[model samples]
Target: METTHGAEHVHVGRDGWLFLTAGSNNVVGQFSRSRLMARRVRGWRRLVVARVRGCERLGCRYLHVIVPEKLTVYDHKLSAGLRVKVRLSPALRLRRALFWHRSARRACLDLVGAFRAVRDARDLYFRTDSHWSFAGCDTAYRLICAACGAVPKDLSGEPQEWRQMAGDLGSKLTPPQSERWPIRGLQRDAVRVHASPIVELRERTGRADKLHVGAHVIYRNDAAGTDPRRVVLFGDSYAHFAPIMLTALIAETFAEVHFVWSSSLDWGYVERVRPDLVIGQVAERFMFELPDDRFDLKAYAAERFGTELAEAEAKSARKPGKNSDKSPGKKPGKAGTSVAGP
Candidate 1:
């Protein structure tokens, strides 16, 4: 296998595969056995313990999921020139650390093992993009359902179409590479009931990437056979609020599903929603930083985009006899709603 360095951030592997060796999170450097990396792993263990205890106090079941990066799952595709060791991945280190903690051990999901078992079967992640494909998302979804003790919804029969696109990793190259990947249909049984103000503003201005940090949304499924439990998911792009990925899959299976696009858990929001299950999902690279679980979605949006949001609302109010019904700077849905999808 021949591997070439394409861009400063991308590692071009054989057979049209692209791996992200460097990015904002310093993907390859995170594998070091340095003292700092060890401390980071310890912090993750503490965070897991706190999450479990916090959920227990709120009378909800919490499941922590760390979505492995492309390099962790597809290391075999890499060229011998790449010297990073997959075994040194932070995700594995964190999992090993959490294994000793009683409560945290059970809360954390072992996705690395799950992904490795089926890595040779098919392409779990996208060839050009840093995110997972429909197949990869489905594998994680099934594992999530089993952990929650909820019956999984089979979306295999859903209509699918392949579209040409350059994913996040592919776009970083000097000569961008593109691929045709399968796109699944929207959730048949679930409908978006509400979207937060930031979400609306992002859609209006076509600046999803910029305004994605605190996005949130809600989906309701009234199907007869769906699970009765309510689910709150604090995740990044992989389990987005969109109907094409992990959020959509969970929404279709449960009565109500709330998707919060933040790596940090908002304790206040969790208490208010009172969901039966709380899920925290983050990309493996993001494990480099530990969150304090104090993220307030509404306060964050206001502080970050106060002026822009106000201007947008004023513009909408100025339209011919259009009166703004949404509360000033408040999310539009029932209580809590924001958005995320990539």
Candidate 2:
């Protein structure tokens, strides 16, 4: 029952497991039985209902997934000194609030229960990282596909390799700890067809975290056995637009998938894409701020990177014998890297 304080925000638990107890989101505070949390639960219920109705009008199926924090799923690994109840999780609270809604059954995925059911079999999340491992991501992926009535692809057979790296939580320690995480060698059939200007600029500058609010990318799968539906996913780092995470799994399952790196939904983009399915994924800790669904990703990107983009374009134009018709920056070589928050 011993708990040792490692970094400023990390709660060092038994067996090298690190849990995030404090940070910008106040991870531990979220489990409190307060009036504020009650109101937030109601707000989330309304938001989910609104999303469901909106998607219905567009003849699109919708699913809202809240990726539970490691503390919620693996609290047993935490020290006895840490007083937090997994039942008080905001995700569970929101689910309870939405229980009366008619769309509840179809609009939300029960990840908390799913994770708890099989957590003891293996490590679903990284020991020292805040993000989930391939096993955890795959679990969610299967649930998503099942909810969408799509056949889930079995990536377990994919080639795998191990690599040691310091995760977000581990890096916060005085002497950073590293773990050998399993890297899935996925033979991805989906190819990146498009990336927004901001993504391109950030990639070129090696600052993928800059102006990341509106980063967007599209993947198209021409492989056999893929679902013949289009999907638009508005999510954070958990469902990243990379071959190694949830986005790639969805893309491999569907014919086309658009990944927007934002928690807020852009209805206009949804209307334009006219996807057959719309998915919104958010981390449980970010339930504090409710999104207004007024996010214009393009405008946000323009506002943030307009000056830099203009400078790059102008600089390129000044070069003699250079093709000005080409895009201002070179195509991004790899997917943008994301570090999970505490």
Candidate 3:
């Protein structure tokens, strides 16, 4: 499940914050020089009283104490029930208000631009949810093509059709929270991936010395030779959606494309299957986290480039040290020879 960082609240803008009042009335105002943002209006006073009464009926022991340090069993149960009752009507109204909000509206416009960048709406995202939907992947492909300044050829003549394949690497790795979310058992749009040298693994009897591997290449028998840039992508599950969408929309633009998720990869896999571009699909949440020993990119980068950085540091260290180590006969400029920069 998604962990809660703190109490939930929505940011309106610089003008002021909109706090949910006792009776579900939105308390909005300009920040005043004084402590309170606003004084209760005439109508709001009655609403507040009604809320207080409701709290009394529900045995709100901590009602008088604003912002309890910790929630108790009674506090949690009562708050949960009250929250449901208070938010049910207000949530819908606020959503409509949010739709008209300039900043919120502008965000949608930017999303539309990203969508247009992909050209094909169908490949933009997953069928069920917003996390890189099938349509989203299509859009990312368009963005990637734009980034590379590559002219995308229309793949209308290519073999592209919707198919109900099993869950891809992406679906398989979805967090448990995703499975437990309110909306369960929704139909997720999936695609059949076609790639040559389809690597499959299995158990074996006897000496099992040989790694059973296979490779195949099918050439189009058509008289017209269609040439497209061959591309290969090595990344996590996130890479699967983008490549699939790209292959669907611009199949002819690339003669062949290969996509592999990180779960079943070795360190040399990227180098072994050289591609025009290597897109590393790591989640931002865990980007700083150290990967497995064999897949430690930070250690690899340090090993490759750390020598130059260390040498530069050592040179800097010498200068400061020489000045700090200066003897009593030396001037302020000669303060270091034995001493180093901290």
User: What total of clashing residue pairs does each candidate reach?
Assistant: 4, 0, 24
lDDT tens string, model 3, 158-245?
A: 2344444222221322231121112111111212233221221111122222321111111111113433344433344344323233
Global lDDT scores for all candidate models: 0.83, 0.83, 0.29
Q: Write the per-residue lDDT of candidate 2 for residues 196-257, one digit (tens) a residue.
A: 77677777778775544677888778788889898999998888765778888898899888
- Residue-level lDDT of model 1, residues 1-342, one tens digit each, is 222364767888878898988767888889899888899999998888999999999999899999998888888888768867878888888888887786788788888899999998988998998899878888999999898888887887644777888898887775778898777875899878777767767876777666567778888787899898889999988987667789999999998899988999999999988999999999999988887698887788779878887888888887887668854434334343333321
lDDT, residue 246, candidate 2: 88
Candidate number of the best lDDT: 1
Q: How close is candidate 2 to the true structure, as a TM-score?
A: 0.91
Question: Ranking under lDDT, best-scoring first?
Answer: 1, 2, 3
User: What ranges in model 1 sit over 4 Å off?
Assistant: 1-6, 324-342
2 against 3, candidate with superior TM-score:
2
Q: Give TM-scores for every candidate, taking all chains together and pairing residue i with residue i.
A: 0.91, 0.91, 0.31
